[model samples]
Target chain A: MSSSATINRSSAFSSPRVGQRNWEYATLYIFLAPFAVLTALFGIWPIAESIRVAFTDSYTALSDSPVYVGLDNFRAVLAEPAFHSSLWRTLVYTFLSVILNVSMAIGLAILLAHPRLSRGRTFFKLAIFLPVITPDVASFIVWKWMFNQNFGVVNQALLGLGLPPFAGVTQPGSAFVTLVLVEAWHHVGLYTLIFLTNLQLLDKSLDESAQIDGADRWQRFIHVTLPQLRPAITINTVYALIEFLKTFTVIFVITKGGPNFSTNFVSYYAYSKFNSAQYGEATAIATILFVIVFAVVAASYWYMEKGDQR
Target chain B: MSDGAVTDQARRSAVRATLESTVLYTVATAIALMFVYPFYWMLVSAFRSQEAILSAPLRLIPEHLDLTAFQTIASIGGTPLSSFAFNSVVITVLATAIGVCATGLGAYALYRNPRLPLFTSVRYSFLLTIMYPHMLLVIPLYFVSYKLNLLGSTLGIILVMSLVPLIFFIFVQFFRSVPQEMIEAARIDGASEWQILTLIIVPIAKPVILTATLVAFLLNWKQWFPVMVLSTGPETYTLPVALISLNTEYGINFQATMALSTLTVVPVVIVFVLTQQRVMGSFMAGAVKG
Candidate 1:
């Protein structure tokens, strides 16, 4: 309230009344300088450099300057069977993980939002959200132990359930599933919290009105509840998509993109190339990833804006 | 079609309600356990011997607690565990402090001057970067650090990390929730813009600011890729990198790895436990409102 008054007072004091606009501009510029300078140096410049490097045959071993062998890096990346499998795997990973993660989060959020469970809300929230705050590398390493082929708790539990012990990270498909499960576990807490917040904000009167209209619990949730949580759903969907797309740490630590590159995500692929000093090829992979991520996010935002108009 | 039949239906409905409530409590408790069990396991495993950790059917309760893994960490590389922790603390604290201040001030400027060209472009650019993952920049960032001679330096990590786009967005969301009248009131009292931000705005915005700080701290604390790429040696390594090194150097020493993992997560867990309500509330409020 006071901020609006200050804004009006300042605006009124501007121009002939007081000449403060120039001062305001100067201060604004100062406030924006750190962001601008850091972003230009690290963010924008690096992005541009990656694009430029993508076209050349740049590698650390080459003494000569990078030649603009246009399309060669991209061509090479496309030709590699490794690249093909990895790209497909990454897409599948993103699609499945986002669906499972977001839906589970919503379910958990709804359960936690129940009025009957109010007494344990903090404990439940803290427990669920704990993983999201834990160090990713730490959690990944611990999960690696949990998924260990011989001594993994998961397999041990399976064996206890009268099931045969199966290789975890040593296999192809199972490795992917393990990675996805770990990823979902690490992330669902955050989305659940987001959904919980939106759930709490929902007008209960609307739910009551639906109930009065003879809608059952499931019907009320599907009809009156889900539609109202669109903003949170959109946010979570895009966030989960982006997060899954750039999932490198878990795959890097647990599998190292092994078991025939089953879990070889694009980001990890790029990092591996970079490690081997294949700078041009790595940047090309990164550029392709950048394009895909940009398109999806932009399209999602556009779709949401269109929905808002209706 | 009598009163007896109506009573029977009412009793059935009551029984159904009880059954439903029981199911809800059961499912919710199970999910919470699944979420929290791993950390509990990690803590327990950290205190177990190598034999205990690798036992076929893992024991939820160890026969005896052992700290050999912690002992290994304590004497690792002739540098104490505290040194790695000290390095992590220094890096995370400085980066978070600088990052939070820059993010808050930048968001405030953008919030106040919504239509200004400089502010608008910067604001949108941060959003654009949020869409583009940081993996794109890591390689070039390595080169950038090398060219600037910031490699293997704490200052370099702090500088690069202080520009995190998501934190910027979080701050922007928080500032948007701050009513303009707050600033207006401060200005009407002959307060400068800086004074307004410091005196009137920041105090009211403490919760979100703290949330952002916690997030910034968490990111820096858990950061691996940047440190892995930029740091040249152990001297400059943060806790995450050190933990990774512990794993690689020790060769499947699950006990030590678990112990180190526990150590790595302790500070963050402590901070989260202490301020869980305020931090989570502030975080969600920003998202919900904005």
Candidate 2:
């Protein structure tokens, strides 16, 4: 129905605009021409060029002329251990980050959405949401200091309790855990705010209908809340995935993808290679990363459609 | 459940509200402290002398306030602290202006008639922009930026930064919500597409445009990544790049680093707060829709 309407509308403009309609269309294109030109130049062209360059042996960003070497860049990228490990790690990191953020966000939204509870809701919202707006470097510095082993508060409290020392950097697993913890802390605020906004717009009668049917708190949340929250959940999860793919500054300020590259996701690895003056390989990595992200997100959407009615 | 002595139930609810308020306040205060403490620590430490910093690890307040960090910010600066603000301002102003005008135009065009060829492409292109990552073009953009001599200039940054996908993200989403029938009605009265956009779409979508501008500008303004990668000269160093440099130089000096961090962050924070109404409005629209 929507497609036909769209097509019908489009065809009307396309066919015969001999009088006033012609002038309107001309003015419309005149307004849109600059944006279209810029998008084609900066947006589409770079993307196309990047994909094309990925098949070559261009290393440095300073290269003016480079001979194309077919299939070699892809082959090299595939053979790289860092590539494989970072690929797997990106999946794990993105999955853990998205799931935890979305769930916690929903939990927070539900708690704050209770209409009768009139006490500390505003303060809680501010406390959680402030971090979302804090500049990336400053937050990174604070988290880095928090995870510091020597005079850091986390370590101090742990020691006071007679717990064993945690070497956040020297140990591999702990470092990974710390990264996860930091990422989770940093992102939870944004997602929580998103869910809260969603919950506020919701119709109150849906939950009431469930409650009258003898649904307990957990039951109300599962059947009533989750079903109504499908749209929010979809938005939250999808955006989370996009964000996790683009994450750089947090890890850059803290770990720099350190502890022997244990935390080098596809995004960071591309940055690292670019930093190393390897433009050809870096672009290849980026292309691959883009492809990976595009594929995963598409697959998820396809799968979700199969599973859910929407 | 509430029928047993309504007055008693009311009293019980009052008591619960009070208790809940206290608990919530306490919990929130603790969390806020946790979030804000490191910057606080940095501020106090910045005022203390080096020896004092080493001696008193947990000083909540400095016994002697010093201007050493501020002095350092003034004297040892190639890109003065003001320049960072200047760079951010130029980018924010130019980029915001461009984004607002362009989105208004593109959105108006699409909203004027969604079925037009250019308008149809604009719709799909805007959607594509939202999905596409900016980082995908960093390397190629570097080559282009270098070739075009856009590597270090503020104008260069403004031009490219103005090309954000988020602009379309803002506009297209907003344009969709405004009814198309309004445009048709206006057209029926012999109003030009430009006139309809200016008088009708502009006024109705004013909140959205403002929101989009605020959000888009801040996103560009806070970003230091492109500057970090493309620009090498200190003269071109953005606040974020400069902050990173400070971190590298004085990793051990908590006082100067954090003080500078706070100083650099405050303007953006202030802007964020002021424009947050618009930000929240756009977000609410997205949340309700998605």
Candidate 3:
């Protein structure tokens, strides 16, 4: 009864004052209006339009009207051998890249966070992260040069060591491996940073208790530290999955979906379709890719939530 | 146990610790080198002649500084380097400025009225949109821009780029931590919401603003896919697009491409170096909180 009376008294005191400040609503709306309009136009509208266009026989960007063709676009896209290969390639690339990236990230995070290795923490962090901040096109272009077949530094180093020359984006056989490596290098830093942040926030007392209970470093990490890192692991896995699945910039710069379509992922494939004025089919591919990404992300979230409950 | 045995164990453990640190340092240094070597190579290659860059027994360091590649890029045919640089600057600046401001305002509005049904829905919608990949929007956006007569224009790019959902989320997160009592006090003092936001909130939120600005700047500056699809002509091409053209047009001129890449990268790198702490802090904030 006393708490209810206090709440009533506070509301009584503030209600009239807040009532008099009606202009605040207008100001707030004014502040929000531009962003809301822009989001609706560019952010929300495009998703809706893309889905709509996927079911239509739209060919050109300038076309005012496109005939609705139901699932024809999807059917056509699904029947194509190129689409099937690109989709498979995308999945394979995404799987390899995500695993490589997340593991490297975990390793680097642990290395950087180690107590004994105090010197040059900042240097290592900065060096790893430099690529993340460097303009993507520029860095990818530089990587392309570094991986050049005849004039590349990579081949030079390998040949100097009296080893057989590594094929760097020149041949179909090794292009996928090259793509994975370059993508991992470009992306692992951000994931590492994420893991490092999580590590810093971990409860140190749990590790101390494990140590006291006769757990060795590996056992403690597996039983205690790794559990604490579950959230970071989930986040990094999902992020890297989405990132590599839709990988475009690297392919655009390095391979252009070649050394004979070895590195042609789905995004680049859809881009090629779009360039050829197969708008309907292109949107269908995009819509399919979107569904896959959304479904995977949703599933991961659900799985993580279930894991947390346990 | 005897005191001598205890001392012996301590010394042995210390030696082992030293060995562990040595191994960790070696691994860390090697990894850092592997990550950083490409950048080092890029910088050096920019200043080397094409022949020197491709020569046998590749020199890690350039023998002599060469300005020919940089000069060549500066005056390449009909579309010069300056135009591309100018387009990039204009697009990045306009997009980041408008993006950061609009995002800040929207976030503030949501933060101030957390209970309002409309604002709550808007907030949730923004959160949901972040899940959709950029590629999914490209096709429709291209058509939309065409319909709106915004295709092949910087205006369209700026507007589209400014609709960044992540920045909005970041701003909202930052604002939520701000004490409500401060805003209430300002309200009671008859300071308008606009005044409170401008005078008080923005000042307190400088770090978030800087972080968002840096992110938006880098994103806009480096954007290739959308810009590539949207731009129909060389005149509208940004640095990245122009860099691609340079490669295709000149038929794999590594020296010139390196110089152009250097131009494109140096500004962002300099900004990043200057504000490294805040950028890292922002990433931590997003990771931990979001």
* Top candidate, metric DockQ: 1
Interface RMSD of each: 3.5, 5.7, 4.5
Cand. 2 TM to true fold: 0.88
Q: DockQ of each model against the real complex? A: 0.53, 0.39, 0.51
Predicted complex 1: DockQ: 0.53
lDDT digits (tens) for residues B58-144 of candidate 1: 778877779788888885666677878888889889988888888788777878887877667776666666566786677878877
- TM of each candidate vs. truth: 0.91, 0.88, 0.93
Q: Per-residue lDDT of A1-310 in model 1, one digit per residue for the tens?
A: 6556456666775462355656667888898787777777777777777888888777532334657888999999999999998899999999999999999999889889987787778888898888888898999898888878665788888878999876788899889988989999999988899999788779889999999999998999999999989889998998888889888889878889988888888999999998998988999999999999988888987998898899
What does DockQ come to for candidate 3?
Answer: 0.51
Query: Where in model 3 is the C-alpha error above 4 Å?
Result: A1-22, B1-7, B115-117
Top candidate when judged by lDDT against the true structure: 3
For model 3 the TM-score comes to: 0.93
Tell me the tens digit of each residue's lDDT in model 3 across B10-39.
999999999999999999999999998887
Q: Please state the error at residue B80 of candidate 3 in Å.
A: 1.3
The digit string of per-residue lDDT tens for model 3 on A151-265 reads 6888889888999988888898788888899889999999999999889989999999999999998999899989899889998998899899899988888899998899888
Off by over 4 Å in 1: A1-19, A60-66, A203-206, A209-214, B1-17, B77-79, B185-189, B285-290
Lowest lDDT 10-residue stretch of candidate 1 chain A: A57-66
Q: What local lDDT does model 2 show for residue B19?
A: 89
Ranking by TM-score: 3, 1, 2
In terms of docking quality, model 3 is medium
- Supply candidate 2's per-residue lDDT for B186: 75
